[model samples]
Target chain A: MIAPGKLARLVATNALSNRRRLALHTFGLVVGIASFAFFLSLSMSVRSVFLEEIFPLDEVEVVAPRVGAADVDARDALNDDVVNEIRQHPDVKEAVPRMAMAFPASGAAMFMGQRMPFEAGGFADGVDPAYVADEDFADRFVDWEAEEHEREACGPPPERECGDHYYCDQRDNTCHKRVPIVVSRTLVELYNTQFAPSHGLPPIDEALEGMLASMLRLEIGLGETMFAAAMTGGESPPRQVEGMVVGISDKAMPIGVTVPIGYMERWNREFVGDEAAEVYSSIEVVLEGREAVAPFAGWVQDELDLSLADRQGERFATAIFIVTALFVMISLVIVTIAAINIAHSFFLQVSERKRELGVLRAIGGTRGDIRTLVLAEAALIGVIGGLLGVAAARVGAAAVDFAAHRWMPAFPFKPDSFFLFEWWIVAGGIACAVVFAVLGGLFPAGRAANMPPAQALSQD
Target chain B: MAGDPIIRLRDVEKSYGPASAPARVLRGVSLEVGSGEFVALMGESGSGKSTLLNIVGALDVADRGHVEVAGVRYGEAKERALARLRNVDIGFVFQAFNLIEHLTCLDNVCLPASFSRGKSPAEVQERGKEVLGRVGLADVAGRKPGTLSGGQKQRVAIARALFQRPRILLCDEPTGNLDSHTGGEVIEFFRELNERDGVTLVIVTHEQRISSAAERIVSIRDGVIEDESAGAPAAKEAAST
Candidate 1:
């Protein structure tokens, strides 16, 4: 039967009288919340990096064969006939046969001006020339002529079929004349310095754009060619070949020259020597649809009786493991310390307010009422702390991005690339703050509720 | 008009500590107070006067006894029911002026009433102000107890006791912390309340001066009543004198 107004006034008075202690308690909770938010954001960001960036490009489903388990002979591993059979399956939209070989090369001429160790290899993939005509894939790897036409409508009308070097306007459009080899921006910039005058190409500026116009020049052994001379034996027969640079792609290139499937088959027959050229160290296949890459890669491995190993997927897994362990342990320690601090603060608050609580009880407040009042105060603290933590995390994230861009310009922190402020992170942060605050308040609130009114009233 | 007793105790006993080493504060004590009677309980410290007063006020339960106040038996009553009885049937005025210091005089007076009964805040305020005015504290109604003088605090306590219109009022040394002049004024307020409102008043104190104000005085020692006497003014003219 207590009047609402009186009860509210009493609660308000008690809270105001001990404002300093309560504020201290709230501060401790804020720190805990901020730490929890940081850890939560970190965990989510790592997961997003794996799923969005690494997983899509690397293809997670193709399992590699266990090491040293009856290694298949190179001749029997992944033949062109087997690859063609996989492509015939209805679910398989596209299949590319690949061959890889690694050789030693000088890395000194790269753009960074320092000779870094380089592994040179030969890569060949047999693809349907029509696959490059896809509008979506073209956006990622090649700038479509249609898009260029759309951008400049009033400019010079596109020339009709400029031979094998460009797309010809015909009833059946195919990019078969000379497929553009995409190279990394790093390679393009480095090669521009060496061959700019001969090609009459524009000065390479942007890394991604530079990759578009660079070509590879290879020297095979007929007798005494540069590559043959550099080999262990002296005075080998020389063979020189020049490849037209059709298109430069922004994708990171494997440390090797990429040739068309037609060129690879011809070169393998002529120069690689029968026993060495027959075995491929590895192969990379890009499926038609991004979603189909995993299943198709799996199918290819099964058909060839060969295994696929994705270095990117393994790297991502290692990154997740290291990051999770480090952050989770740090967060656990921070939150535990904060919880203890909050508990001590609340204990002191209750002890100091014994008389106030006694007065409330004497004035007809039940034990339930006292407990509710204490819990409400704790909840309020948690809410404020949670908001502060979120704000701090956002500010910290911005500072981190800025610092990264300034310090590591080559690998600038890409804001859009990382997951930030995901829904689950926010929800979990708030829940953690509240739960911690409650845990801190439990013992103190219980003691306050059970205090003898007579003794409490008698206390000074 | 004479009526049934408002408070009754039969063989009430209260002990402290464990059974082997228990110290009995009250042993086989019995007493009664009629409706509208004003009685003063006089005893030295530790003579069980305060314990008896507490038992009568329903603030504590006797270890072995039948204690009844306003027709409710204390021993069998539930905790909530006892609280209800304390809230509505009995009003207490403590010796040390146990006014909630955070509250204004009017709010302090009205708290028990607000808790025990259903009344709008505005109504409670109006009633509280009226009671304060009755105790000659209308001007200080907004002042908290901390700022008020001792006598003023006691007046606020009395006002709070009267606001609920209880059947019995228990005062444990209501003027103990005040000066002689302030204490006399407080006693007068209590006397005025007893005479004008027909409220039963039970005062526990060792002060001889306060006994003069009561209609009857009972003295106790060693946990038992030693003597009982009518007040001087009533004794000579009464048949029981």
Candidate 2:
């Protein structure tokens, strides 16, 4: 046995002399540790986003129609009358009826008026504009209010202008008086070509702001007018109509053309017939209190005998989350294998320092003293590596964000948006690195303990 | 004037390997050294001279033996007790010097004392410095073992062995690694320590020239003692009278 102080000195001397080897071992450990940290941080961020942002809003109470369920008929779609009745229920605060009508042969034409097949769907709904004002709903659907502000500031066009009326569309992109219409850039281009000559509208190649100012002409019930006279086997109405463009919007409507419910009802009664207005395809409801939302939605589904589809969307999102987590776990496995390699390297180093260890033993070193020296070295490696790994991850995340924003502005690559960096992630990485290092040294330390002093002396 | 022997061995047998093929290194070997006597064990290689020395110093165990060093039975002693005996009752000096290469000469000397009970760092340092001064290595106390010559390292080993004030000193080919001149110097230091301190000394060697320094010389052949000679003309005269 050797004195601990002497043993420590010997160990330190050996370690220092063999610094290059130590550094190599440490480098391996650090890389493994850093990889683990980066992956774990990413996993945690993704999980948090899914749990706190997407899942909570979509999954907690909502239920969706099961896959392969029968297509809902017009009568079974919970008509406006039934929807109104459901809203009058004590639990229900407000219920908005939604109707989706498929236009089979009436496809969106190309800008050049050469008919390209475009199957379209019409979504009609009676919704309180105030429902759009709900903070939670606004936070989800319209993330920014600046677009709305810009539309408001621009006001209405001359032909459609009405005094003191803040006209707005469902997409929140366009605002004006008579009837504000929000259309996609694609739709605007098409409309410009179709009506430019007869209506004196601007060309499609003009800038968006200029096209909106000159080319946009609204046609009241264009589809309905064509459908009516044809029902009696008469000549169809002209393919175009004359109306003023009220305002241009920032985005296309998510579902269909967002006409006011009053306008839709008037069009149905005058041309498309009253029978078409009776049924709704969906409903957007708002409860007075968040606590009442679940019960009201459930009661509406049961009372109206309508299968809800919101829950299915939630299930799909959950599946996505599981897949993402699996990917993260696979990355962790790779990091763990790398860490094991680091441990193996450290073990080899310990074997190389056998003579030095024997000297310590002869001088009076306890087993614990040797173990501490090895462990200390390992811990140092882990800490250094962890810091480097974190820095690398941050750089990686920044690069991802930059490329995503540059290439796909519509879908910004926000690293922090899905995977946030947390303190525990860093701590976990360091702990893992250190633990790996110590574990790596265990076999070598044991071999050192069992070595005979005489043999060790003779070897040197 | 025969006093109780400080070290005693009776019918000690040491062998290596299993019973069937065991190589009996020490067979029925018995020897004793009186307190304060300087003894030398001389033998050719493979004669178990070093093995006997190791048993007496508690560095090894005999398979069948009743052996005692400083009143403790070596065969029946536990590991802790054996370590204590090795630390306090016996000190070892090897042919290779066996100094920790990273330590300064003073630290090498002070090592055993650091492991012993009731010794502070300051006291250990002071004692180590004193012994290094005695060994004429006081100037090189701050230098590492790699910096010292072979003679210096052996001197440091001797100083280390003596610093603990053990009851017995064991040396195994202490000057084997050094040149003839430096070997003579290290042997002179051993003679001085034994003569001045009255510490019992057991030295194993093959060189007949080094045997003259011992007070008594025991020669072994084939693991058995062949001859024993009394040391000094005065001790021989006294024995004759």
Best by DockQ: 1
Off by over 4 Å in 2: A1-13, A45-355, A366-410, A416-421, B1-10, B31-37, B56-58, B66-90, B102-134, B138-142, B156-168, B195-200, B226-228, B233-241
How far residue B216's Cα lies from its native spot in candidate 1, in Å, is: 3.6
Interface Cα RMSD of candidate 1? 3.0
Residue pairs with clashing backbones, model 1: A182-A249, A211-A248, A212-A248, A222-A237, A222-A238, A223-A236, A223-A237, A223-A238, A224-A236
lDDT of 1 by residue, A1-460 (tens): 4445555565566556556765776666566666666766766676666545445443322233544236644444555555566557655545454444322222212222322233333332222234445422342333232232322112113633344234332323333233334344445545555445454544555443534333222222222234534542443233433233444433334234444444444444444445434444443454455556556656656565555565465566667767866775676566666667777887887887777666556545566666766765666566666777767777776776677667743331133423367876677767777777777778888888888555565524
DockQ, computed on Cα atoms, for candidate 1: 0.33
Q: Which ten residues in a row have the lowest lDDT in candidate 1 chain A?
A: A148-157
TM-scores for candidates 1 onward, in order:
0.70, 0.63
Question: Per-prediction DockQ scores?
Answer: 0.33, 0.18
Candidate 2, residue A371: the lDDT equals 62
CA displacement after TM-score superposition, residue A374 of candidate 1 (Å): 3.8
Candidate lDDT scores, in order, read 0.63, 0.60
lDDT of 2 by residue, B123-185 (tens): 888999999998898999999989888998898988888787887888889878999999888
* DockQ, computed on Cα atoms, for candidate 2: 0.18
